[model samples]
Target: MKKNWMALLMGIVMATLLLSACSNEGSSNEADADGGSGEAATEQVLKIGNDQEPAGLDPHKVPAHSSIRIYEKIYDSLLTFDEDMKVQPELAEKWEQPDETTYVFTLREGVKFHNGREMTAEDVKYSFERIMDEETASIAKSYFDKVESIEVVSPTEIKFTLSEPYAPFLSYVASTNAAIVAKEVVEENGDLNQAAVGTGPFKLDEWLPDNHVKLSKNEDYYKDGQPKLDGITYLTMKDESARLAAIRTGEVHVTTLSSQSIPLAEKSDGVEIKSYQSTEYSYVGFNVNKEPFNDVKVRQAISLAVDRKEVADVVWKGDAVLSGPIPESMGQWAIDVSQEELYQQNIEKAKELLAEAGYEDGFETVISTASTYTDMVDTAQLLQQQLEAIGIKAEIKQLEWGQYIDTWTNGDHDMLVGRNSSGSDPDRSIGFFFSTDGSANVWGFSDEKIDQLAEEGRTTIDPEKRVEIYNEAQKRVIEQTPNLFLVSPEKFFIVRDSVDNYSPTANEPENFNDVVIME
Candidate 1:
């Protein structure tokens, strides 16, 4: 299984040393930001460690969380999720659902984009219409498929017309995918890939590709006396140990920690580990458009070979629970894969299924994973061992965050290990990934019945009917095996003790507006 006890032990020791070193080296230089160590703490900069570097700054194009982290800083949606995941106002101060198919929103006045132009209802309409446009191919398009039209009522009001009733629509609006953009800016730059102009608390200052993204405070932010920090620096530290080391060395103020690094972070000085339950689920996805996986039996056989419980225990150290196509964080909407026979691992049965699929000797395939996410790497390595038991020779392809995302996004790999956030609703959890036109459906899985049921689940407002629809949908996704559903690990973010008001939100990207770094 490529398990190295020594490497793990060394990793813990190294992680500790790395984080400790950062605190020592950064303390002196960190003082320079405020003029001197003895001077008053001014121009407070919150240095954050990003395990996966953002591929781009565009919200409509890149759905990667790394990119979303920056998007949440640079852009504002009509609505947002509070720390409790309850919907709250953002760009749109208030809204109303006059009917099942209509929504009217009144935009807050004088809210200016990073470029100083006031955000009008036209900008909001343009932002959503751009995503709905077929050419843009936004991954979040499926979530808004019911959006029939958008109309600007006035300079401060926008109206939306839906073709059908979609219960999960509001939650989708709260997603960064629906982030507002400056129409003139997008037209000028071709895209927000290199340039970002949004109405947010922080404005983009400097973005050094593969290095860091620096953001400065928007003095004209709509919120009064908020965004406490003078600036936020997103440091791309792709390695888990390296990130922890950055924390230890005090090179960065905060970073997300993997289960493997939790113990190391917990014991480290000058750090406070804040954790919460999250909607994230990790899975091994098969590109159903490709062979070997093109056949459902092959996909099912491979899925049946791996033990999910073992994966949870070994990888997440029991901090996670077994997940299905829908994650446990979805509550009653999620099916208990532990009770499902399809999720139970059986090498002999898996071999039989492979034989029936005319690959009795098994097949050679690649499992692409991101090098930035160590848990995904560890999961791939363990799956490599488990698959070998059924005679399948699987090669592990570990690429950097950018390449790995590209490989999966373009369906260039047979299979891949990736983790995703499911959000608060089941429709967002399921439709965003497995539905025929699901924005995250890079697995190339498209099914008529699954698509129909997903539509039904969202359109049918009856809670009982929704439960039945999603239940059936979940079972079908499991049987079809587009993805070998794994576990939903808890959220863990390690922060320096100097940082305050650092609570992590369950539904949105990490927002640094309220965070303060004591100099």
Candidate 2:
């Protein structure tokens, strides 16, 4: 952990100063199709900072949020979600759903990747098939589990044949993982960990792990002089305070802040606050296969004991919304389990349940969290206190982000606070955590009924029926106690006042390319 922290500090220092090598130099006079007449000042350089550092440079091997952000900046997908969170054209100019189980994407014409290689249907098929190969170790493989095969119909057209009627297929491909890559580069490098090539608005110039990544605007970008900034330097810093300080000091142009840091930005000059509802939902997941936790009464008791509102207010500074497993932002698909039916900090009910479950004397348990998110640490500590009050001997362990996540996914702990970034669709969020074989299901929870409902929701063609199926699944899940659904926190961003057009989006990592400095 210390080594990574030091590396992150070094990365930030280097990112702010070092200018990496560029292969091509082009005129900046190209018109901005989005709006501007290519008349912006030529001195634009956006310095973005974040609290987390990429575990590695490989998008295929590393699924961490930090690395994906870098990948998104440099890669293009067959289709991408627009600002409205609807599927829009990217590498694929248009697509058609010929049947319930098959969809065809038409590749854009004359699209050249950073390597000057023209994007063809074969490259698109290769990128999709690679992510599904278990050897690639992509976190996105689970989402594409139903995909049967990818066949190139023509140089400009590719067909995706799925084993089942998957409603979210197109949106799934629109994910950051499905970002199109050059088949030539991946074959030559034979190692995704060291390779980087894409057709996005920027080209990766240099990646110094943990310190910084430098990306110059791709001159041959398909969108034509898109990414208005001359170049973007992503500085990885672990300290939230340091990151906020950098933004205010003008050491960096933008940085993300935690809920607690919102007040600091609100009070400070030369800083702008941007907030949006995050698809993320916080929960306390119990290892349902374990001895005490296996008893649904015991799990419900723990859920009832903790005060979620108190934790959200005191720890998060009331910057978040109280949410169950299904966040309200999910809208129509959101299932209202009701605050009364769910846990509500009732000590008497918790004690009653504990006694009913033959654990009146309480039991010993361990709670785990990562230090990268200080709020998680605080939440764990509070849970420890609350559980102890119920006569349960609770211990808290703080692990580094990498170790923490690995341990959680490997099912090595009793319980942990977890979150999932719900994508554009509710099915995307619901199906991932509750399904029996879900890769992110850390609690080892399995229920045939809930699994069936989730599957039904996924394949159900009718919107109303899908929502009903998902609602039933959510109810069953909330009742099972694998999750003590807590709160939905807002995605907070603090940037320099000079930064304009920083519209916050539903996506956790919103594009900062739209931003420009007043100077």
Candidate 3:
């Protein structure tokens, strides 16, 4: 009897052990079915080191480049540009031009804002009206000068009436400046300079001024299974060295690398460099309203003095292409005019022109630039040397980006070393700078012929005719010498190997909505 009882006890113990083992196996399988581990199940975050802190959260108020880097992820424009630089639908599912001066847009359905409010045509109207409002003082207002009125036909349909037949209106709508904002949110948050609420792939989570801005994935994003990453954090690393260091230490997943730092990044472990042909060109812009620079001969002389190839080879490490007033990225709109005579380094000709311009002794002037832009600073220094060689005393005045912008916009500087958008369209690229009332015409360059040509180009509906008009305008601009056209530097991004689908556009900001992280 004792043996039988012991056998039974042993059987029970064995049965219990077997059941426990089965339960443990099932739990493991369940966990695996859901996601490998707790860590894997958790949200994936991507950290990026932005070269500079965004000036403001309001897309309408800040500089397009830096602000768009942030706004592109937070807001949705009526239209968006594709890889081919073609206008594609974004918030507007479809659009049509009923007439030369009328555009009708149909909004996407089932789109919800971050505040759980449905987007309507009225919101679009309100957003655009806000930009056009004199009280708003939106920097983007100039871009929409042709917009006469916006009519909300229905909840999903809207129409835009133009004062003239503006050919670049569609492209303008696709630009960062035309990003649609939630009317309710804008109303609630008067300025929207500090906070943002939109129907983008991500929602503003937190903003630690001068440090970082955190964004979380919008679960209710219009596109299904989008914004693969759970969140993104943009760490403001103004110093290029600090940004590179952050990338090396894994503090940041991606950051833009200067041409000089490309070698360093290439040698760094677990770093990958991706290069893109950018639609941005660096140029030495002259305040045409100022002395010496006002003379076309002086401008042309300075343009001839600097060797663009040397600048490209030395300052840009031969990673840039010599560009004209319009970059080659403008497709058919870019006319390859023979600037050989003007771009050639002719010191004697430059001196003769200077002498003719009443600067026989060579005058001294300050070249204002932003210190944060290392490439621009280097280019400015190189330009200073070149100008000195021509007997012109060029003083480099590097200031903080904010101050630099202030001084440049106020037309307080004699010369400005900076980069400007060589947009996909002629109006956006050339007209913005050369047009009589151009918003970016801080140089005070005004020509009736150029203005008339720009107007024709903007109003012409035929692509070929528009191109012809712009080509003429470009020729005139080159002759006027408002800017000493330089090299268009290729943008280099240092990304981690683990990051997937991290393609950035030359014209648009980096989009991380489709990015995913691999273990």
Candidate 4:
């Protein structure tokens, strides 16, 4: 019986070893089939959570931040800013300033649009003329007001003739609105509203409004071995809470976090926080065309009573720097107003000014804000309380971005809380807002000297002379209280550990061509 038991045990061990050997052989064969890897192939996808859907993808038409984010993805300008915000050649290989009013650009060879059409100087000329056309009504129309003509010197060379020396000309050429589009593609589609075809690293695969936008990599991109990921998907989470949840749960790879939500986001194990000093300044704008606000004393009184530091602390967790007419982020152009006594918060003085303006008892007014912008909402709420100290009763009117923009642009509000972009050039930041003929002079706040200075600054080519011109413009505008220049906050954006090669830009979306995934 013992011998029979040993034999039986040996037989069982042999059977077990044979089964294990067969299984190992099958695994090895499977690995060989999968290109020497046991794991199945994986597709790297970058998912971004956006707070709002883009109103439109036509870069020349929509200037909203939501739309601009997507524009940075699917468009490339002749010139683009580097990581350090210096001008770098993009579509144009090299450019020369032949004269103060004449600039020339040389197009790169073999660059093609998403539609597989070769890019040429004519496309650049068409794009510029289309933007300058009055029928288009582009926000950039004013930016190129001085461009007298565009000439396609050759298939690869383009020349621009300016009516006068526009100092910020080159900088504006690198701005977001200068994105070049394929002329034939635009004509075929009627407009670029639904179709986004460009000579960019990514091609717009799909854009489902209010849902998500998906893009696929451009295999034929001019820059080789870039756009490391297979594709990118922008998911619209209108609710800030939803955006936060998506990032924390790894449902989305990246998203922006509000200042108040930073502490909560820091606790997420899978998330990484990134921050930068933003070029945006939040303010309570008064329609200088409207009554009470039309009175400079009333504007000054409100500006004095509202403590900027208190607003910064409450709205941004003190993650802000006091700013002047041009935000300090622009460097050299932004005037430091911290030491100035006018910006000092003095409630008694504000009350005195109000009384002098014949409003000892402050009147009722509404503070307009977009519901989606948490920071703006919070800033408005804080201002509502801050204005109370000086007897100004403010009712917060929350609107959707669309309605808010409509009302804000049309100057249909008693007051509005919003943020403005401190553009790459001081002209964009100041000239368009304070000049009398400015299209974006939404506040109806115009001064003769401000207008003259803006024109002079545009015409002047010397940097030092332009600085003096803009400094005087900023000081004069701030004194008139067109809009109360508030604090420039440090903006925080969140990403996952899987995401690499990303540093958040100050005023625009981060280009993801060099971004890669760990797995």
Local lDDT at 109 for model 2: 89
Rank candidates, TM-score, best first: 3, 1, 4, 2
- Report the lDDT tens digits of candidate 4 across residue range 231-345: 8999999888898899999899899878899999999998899999988888878998887899999999998988899888888898999987788888889898787656999
TM-score per candidate, chains pooled: 0.90, 0.88, 0.91, 0.90
In terms of lDDT, the poorest run of 10 residues in model 4 is 32-41
Give a tens-digit lDDT track for model 3, residues 321-349: 88877887777877674465787789999
Each candidate's number of clashing pairs is 13, 1, 0, 0
User: What residue runs in model 2 are displaced by over 4 Å at the alpha carbon?
Assistant: 1-42, 188-191
> Which stretches in model 3 have alpha-carbon errors above 4 Å?
1-43
Error of 2 at 42 (Å): 5.2
User: 1-519 in candidate 1: lDDT tens per residue?
Assistant: 347987898899999999988876676565444334432245589888988778888898897888888878888899988766678898899999999999999999999998889989988888898998889878678878899999999999999999989889888898887899998888999999889989889999999988999999999999986787899999887767789899987888888988878999888899988877778889988988888889999998988899888898888988898888778777778877787877888888899999999999988999899876779889999999988999999899989877987887888988889988777678876687888788888888988889898889999999888999999999988988888889988888898877766677566437666665665
Better model by lDDT: candidate 3 vs candidate 4: 4
Give per-residue CA lDDT, model 2, range 178-292, as digits (tens).
Answer: 8777777888988555668888888888877677888898888777546667788888888888887898888887888878788887888888887888877887888888889
Off by over 4 Å in 4: 1-41, 507-509
* Model 2 clashing-pair count: 1
Candidate 4, residue 367: CA error in Å? 1.0
